[model samples]
Target chain A: MFLAFDVDSLKYDAAGLIPAVVQDVRTNAVVMVAYMNKEAVKRTLESGETWFWSRSRQQFWHKGETSGNVQKIKEIFYDCDRDTLLVRVEQKGAACHEGYFSCFHYRILPDGGVQVVGERKFDPAKVYGKNGI
Target chain B: MFLAFDVDSLKYDAAGLIPAVVQDVRTNAVVMVAYMNKEAVKRTLESGETWFWSRSRQQFWHKGETSGNVQKIKEIFYDCDRDTLLVRVEQKGAACHEGYFSCFHYRILPDGGVQVVGERKFDPAKVYGKNGI
Candidate 1:
C-alpha cells in the first residue's frame, strides 16, 4: 500500500512546517529529526537530497552542505496523519553535529540513568570549527 | 558520550511542543512520531506509558487508553538539539490507528511510486467503529 508524493495532501502546521525523520537506509537506524517548510520540501524533491528548515537559524539548509555528511534521499513517506515524514537516505559520515552516527546517541535507563549508545564518528569541532559549524 | 535527561536543558518550541519519535524496543523499528507538551512528558515519565499531545484535538492523550494498544515505555532520550525526543517502547498492539503495526506503512519509491511495506495487525473499524476510534 503505497501512495504518490502529493504535497497538497500533507497537513502542515500553522507555521507551514512539517516534521521529517531521517533514517539510515542500510541499518534502518533513525538518524535525526528536523523540520521542513514548503520551500524545503520542494528543494528536497528537486534535488533528491535532504533539506531542512532550521528553527534556530530561521533559514533553509541542505544537509551536509557544511559538514559533507550529505543524506542522499532514497525514499520518503508521510505518516497516515500526513504531518510527519519518514525519509530513508544513504547517509554519508555522521548524522549528529556532535560527531555521532545518529542524533539519538544517549540511552535512558530504567532506573533513570543515562548511557551513550552510538559511537562517535568524527570531531565536530574539527569539521565545523571551534565555534561550531 | 551520554548525558542525563535534564528537562531544563530542553528547548521546547514556541507552542511548547516537542516532537517524540517512538521505536520498538525489540525490533528497533520506528512505530510513530508524535508531539509532546510539558504535561504529556511529565505524565509519560510518571506513568511509564507513552502520552502524546494530539495536534488536532489540541489535548493530551495517553497511548492505548481507549484502544488498549498500549505502549510501555522502555527508554527516552532527547537529541543533542534538545528539540526532539527518542522514546523506546514495548508495543502491545498496532501503533497506528489504521490498524497497522506502525504509522509508517506507506513507502515512497525513487521514481515517485508508493509501496505498503508493513502488515495490518487489526481491523481499526472493528476496534474503533465505522467512523474510527
Candidate 2:
C-alpha cells in the first residue's frame, strides 16, 4: 500500500532505525534483513544499492563494499505500518558474510537440530581473511 | 557452527530483544520478521511454536491465537552474530494480517513503482472484524 516515495511517513523506533528486508529480485528469495537509520536509507535510495547501519560496529556500510557481493537495488517498498522496508535487489555472489547465498543457511528441526539448507557459495576465511576484512 | 543450545550467548539489544526471522519450512519462503524477548524465546522453545513480544502493544502473544494462522515451529537458529534468529516453521493459512502468505507481498521496481507479486489469502475485515480483533 505504501507506493509513494514519502520517507517522512515512516515511523522510526526510538533508536531512529527501521528494519529492511532484502530479497533477491529474480528468485524472490530473502537474502538478509538489516537495520537502517535515516542516513542509510537516504544513501540507499540515492545510490541504488543497499546501505545498512551496523549495530555492532556502530557504523554504516554499503552492502558488498567489503566483499564483491553487492546488492543492486531494483525496488523498495514499505509495509502498511511503515515500520519496515522490503528491498528487492539483484544480489551478486553471496549475501552471507559466511559465504552462503543467504544469511539463513541453516534450518532447525523439531528436535532442536540444525541442517544446512543453503550451500556455501564462498569461503569467509578466504574472502574476509582470518581476522575478517 | 552455532549448534549449541546456549541461549545465553545471544546478544540482545539495549531494548532486551532480538529479531526473529520466520520462514516457511517447506517452501523456505520468509513469512515475517518480529522481535522476541528472553521470555518469548524461552516460551517459543518450550511450546514448540512462536511467541512474540509486540513492540506496539508492549505485550506477548502466541502466533495464531486469534486467527488460527499459527506457526508450528520446526527449528530455530541464531545468526553467527547471535543478534538475530531464523525460525523455520510450518505456517498455517496466511502469515500477513492483510491476508497475504507473507508480509513481503509487493515487489518494487527500479523506477520506484510497486507491484503486488503475492496473492491475497484472506480478508482482514472478516478475520479481525471491522476494526481488528
The residue-by-residue lDDT of candidate 1 on B26-107, one tens digit each, is 8877889988988787778778898899877898889898789999987788787878999888998889999998898877
DockQ, per-model, please?
A: 0.46, 0.33
Residue B126 of model 2, lDDT score: 87
Error of 1 at A133 (Å): 2.7
lDDT of 2 by residue, B75-120 (tens): 6766656678878789999888888888766655545566776788
Q: Looking at the true structure's interface, with contacts defined as alpha carbon pairs within 8 Å between chains A and B, what fraction does model 1 recover?
A: 0.51
lDDT of 1 by residue, A15-117 (tens): 8999999989898888999899977887888788899999778998899999999999887877888788898889999999999989988766655566788
* Docking outcome class, model 1: acceptable
Best by lDDT: 1
TM-score for predicted model 2 compared with the true structure: 0.83
Displacement of residue A25 (Cα, Å) in model 2 is 4.1
lDDT of 2 at B44: 85
Task: Quote the B-chain TM-score, candidate 1.
Answer: 0.92
Interface RMSD of each: 5.2, 5.4
Tens digits of per-residue lDDT for model 2 on A12-109?
A: 88889999978797876677889999888878887888989987689998989989899998777676566788787899998999888877666555
